[model samples]
Target: MAMPVYNFGAGNPDPGSFPSQALAEATARVLEGAGETLVTYPDPKGHPPLREIAAERFKKNNGIDLPVDSIALTTGSMQAISLVCQAFLHPGDSIVTEEFSYSGSINCFRKFGVRMIGIPVDDEGMNVDALEEALKDLARRGEPLPKFIYTIATNQNPTGTMMPVSRREKLLSLAQSYGIPIVDDDCYADLLFGEPAPTSFYALDPDSVIYIGSFSKIMGPGMRLGFFAAKEETLAQVLYWKIDGGTNNFAAYVTAEYLKDHLWDHVREINGIVKGKLDTVVQQLDAQPDAFLGHSNPKGGLFIWVKLPEDVDPVRVLELATERNIRYGTGKAFDSQGRDVKYLRLAFGYASHRDFEEGLPLLADCVREARAITLEARV
Candidate 1:
């Protein structure tokens, strides 16, 4: 018999929640109306219509005026990360990022022989004070400054923490002081429930910050659409490195049509679903006080990062979870050095209500089992 699996990992969206009918209708319309324009070899920068939508949405939300020429569409946001590294990173060079960041990005930097200098994150998000100290120490030692400070400030991965605007301003100030650039991945910014997320770094300082946004979470990940907006000078470099002529023009056109007026409604619908999942999981975890450590509901993000007792090992906990057909992402995956941590980054985005009701308690049981085994070994 097959195992009854409950996945609490992967930042993917709920498959059932996708508006496939709308997408199909839009796709048919795009081909019928714009097939002649889109079928040809597409521009590397992006389809002009998609770029305009991206720019308009960004400016409308953040109140920042960004030129359409500054936006570049990618196969996905990971492509944007690769282009950024290719443009700025060299072997043995370093970049600053939250201690816990997207693994794909961390791998991208490491593969290119760039180093990740991790800055600690707290409840509010990346600590600007700590960043200043690190920056000062590096200058004092005459060490080469990082290529840029890569951050996912809006909906931080693994930690699901949001950086307040004050810290963002301070970070930008420090980066300016050090002459470092900022690569802000606002991938999860639009998946908000309440008050809008803090202003983006690019909104505050376009000249120094490269901002990224995605249509995956809003429209569903299968769309494979994301955008990067930077100053013209920086955008030129990204375009130069865009080896693939362009992403699927049909995808771009269909998404542009769908987002033309329905974006807010779509975001709100998905946010309600994800927010409900988060609430359900948080409630269940709260009930298992001994087995599960608590985490506050994030302002707006896909994950709810949970802590464990000092003696509990996430690896062991995962081992126990697997036996029960449950899967969750542990913090070690996000750590560059693969250090042990009593933390789990449970993504509620894709999980269903059943996954929560069943998996949460199973997770607590797994944790308790792991805790007892570790305690016995210590004894």
Candidate 2:
């Protein structure tokens, strides 16, 4: 039988780690307690208990007191981004984003027909200086400042770099000075493996930041639970665009039931699981330095962004990877322009640990193959 591909495209939690029994129990409790509520439409703002609980948990974890009025539940954090962009972005309007970012959010913004201004991000996260420059350049050109700055501040997708506290402050200062709002995606913050990474941008400037969080990393994506906090005015507009009437009631209720006490424990266990995957994959890649460039040593998350050697074409690497039944996300996916980038998002989530031990070297081999193709093309 052919060796099945290692799927490293999704930043999903390990399926085996999902507390199926716990969730099952939670579901039973919800149905037995209030089965009728599930059939009724949930509040467009969100189910009240879920919102209240989320606000409490957020404050406990991040030191940000997002009141119930400021919060709105969504199908997933992905939907929160959509609601913001749909309500704020118009055709020809501009928004700033990390040079490397979440592909889903990028794609979602594009549908609004807004222009995306890419600001390059680094180890400590989005370069505030570059963001200032980008904003200034737009202002100088007489184009209106972007409607908002969209960012994945912690455990950034594709690139797992968290924005350091220093940069987060600078960023807030710059945005506030420019009167620009921020769409902060903090979905991956709870996945930290080591010391706590940093506080939410919303914590520093709650009024100016629309903060989104999710249970996908800590609980389960199938739960379809994510929520956001924003200023009253901004949140009202966001809810107006939330045409779903409400988020999934049963999923939200079950998650609310599951998280009454288990949030931190579940997240800690997943972090260790993800860390083991990261360790295995990194060890294999370390065997061939010249084959690839450096990767982010994620404190905790599903991905390590690997830069390919200069001569290696990412498309060629992908071509060879597909042949070998190895799947990975190219950095190109995260870009609005879809320009070629010499990088790959290798998700250690979802895929098996044994697959990591086996697939990574094959991935490195593909890198070498891609380099060969580049050399051949030049001849």
Candidate 3:
């Protein structure tokens, strides 16, 4: 008999928490109320009510007063990112980002032929000092300023570290001094647990920061809804690049209707689920403190980053994990230079409680075996 497969790789949402009944009810209401609109194209900026809802949510959550015109709905945050890349970047242009970042965004930047200058990240998130030093170095070499500073400040992907407000202000100051704009990705902001989230970059300086958020993390990714708030000038450019006739109207309408009534409650429910999973992951990792050197203690996020012993080979771990029907993300997958092999990200969002209880130990065993192999090689 084979061991059951447990995939801990992708940051997928827990299906058990999905608001299926609520969404179905919302969908019926939307169709009954505005079925006629389906005959024509959706508003290019997205369903109008959805935009208003997005802006309202933004203001309520981040304390930023954004006009609806300054927000554009996209298929998902990924599309929003692509639109920004399309509008702002030319081949050989540069972007400043964390040393390890959301791989999807990294891939998107690569597609645009943009150079990414990576800065180190600590517990509080991107190290502003390193960013400034990089800025100084570029200026010293007479290089053009990067197109923008991209950051996933709150509940950052893979690592699960959130930036403190002080760090955000300093980073904003650096961008201002360098005459560079900031692309602030806050898709995971709403999912934070335990502590209150820090101030948003958009709220601190709307003019200099292009803020992006998504329903994927809060509601569910399949809903495929995301939006960005920026200055009118920035929004205009991003809109021009959004060639898709519009984001899905059906999803937008249903999501807007559901969120208007149940957004916070839904967010609380999902956060509880993810937090429990994260706790389980932490506990499992704690059991093997020797094999897993250390892990990030994210306040609220879908992943926990684990550091393996120095001699443990990540490739060998992956190979062993594959045979055992376990999967995870390597640190190199998120690295700007694709050179790191000392870390791995275990996603706690999708796996069931039983899966985490059973699978994580197996993953730790794989690491132990890999470490043994490396030690034998050394001998």
Candidate 4:
């Protein structure tokens, strides 16, 4: 039997769903005028027009009050994160992040040989009590205080929990008292599914928080365009570290042109489609109450974290699901210790509900099979 190839593992959106027509039109306009400039090494900082458009969008969407000079265009949000890590961290410097965080960010810190301390999180996001304790513990040990606290404040990945406004304020206060900066990753903020999107942490603490945003989720990841906003001082410091020859000029040009021409309307339309598919997945999982122990109703973003019963080993289930043509990310991938794993991060933005609806039942069956196998092995 041929195994199915449903990839719920990656956070990528369906390529066909991207606004190809709109982007194509935008690219044509740029290419017509981008003559010798396209062949030359572009601005090291970024294309000025794109930075201006990004500044406007940031103010409109995130309520960040920043001039265009405060924004730096990067190849992707990943590159922005790397720049921050490199600029702020030294051999003995440390960072505080959520207990379960974006694996890519963790890998970046590892590359710098910086110490990472994972703060525990609850439904509201990173646990405030745990953060305070961690800070105090570091202080008592005579260890260097964390240079910055990195967070996915809104629509957090994996857990899909939005950090409450009060918690954001509290975190800012704690970091301020400790003289620590906050790196706010708002890549998924614009995808809010409901009314009253929370104000960004950058809006709350513009002076202390450096904000990173990406069009990958909005336009297409393949575009590899993202921006980081900070106070001029920090922006200048970070810009010095951008040794990518000339700042990603082509990406900036395409993104700037797209935004200036108001092509985000098409992007918003794609988001609507994603939201519907996300709702369908939630509804389907809701119907199978016995199989799904706990899950998040993501307000925005592409992923939902599902907790399964104790007997179900999500890693084994993921392997079994591969045999059946379905794929998922196991809890261990997001955890530090990678033990007692029973959670799965499911991405619903890329596939049709029909795909998930058909594959989910088989996924549930895989869980059952994994549990049975564990019991058999133990006996």
TM-score of each: 0.97, 0.96, 0.97, 0.94
TM-score, structure 2 vs. true: 0.96
Model 3 agreement with the true structure over 37-145: per-residue lDDT tens digits: 8877988788878888777767776776778888888988999999999899999999998998888998899889988898988888899989989999999999999
Estimate every model's Cα lDDT from 0 to 1.
0.85, 0.84, 0.88, 0.80
Candidate 4 lDDT by residue in tens digits, 16-79: 6776676678788888868778888877667889778767767776665667777888887889
Greater-lDDT candidate between 2 and 3: 3
Cα deviation at 312, candidate 3, in Å, is: 1.3
User: In model 3, where do residues sit more than 4 Å from their true spots?
Assistant: none
Q: List the pairs of residues colliding in candidate 3.
A: none
Q: Kindly give the number of clashing pairs for every candidate.
A: 0, 0, 0, 2
Prediction 4 global C-alpha lDDT: 0.80
Q: Model 1, poorest ten-residue lDDT window?
A: 30-39
**At residue 50, what lDDT does model 2 achieve?**
79
* Cα-based lDDT at residue 184, candidate 3: 96
Give lDDT tens digits, candidate 1, residues 27-92: 887878585786688887878888887887787668877789888999888888898888888899
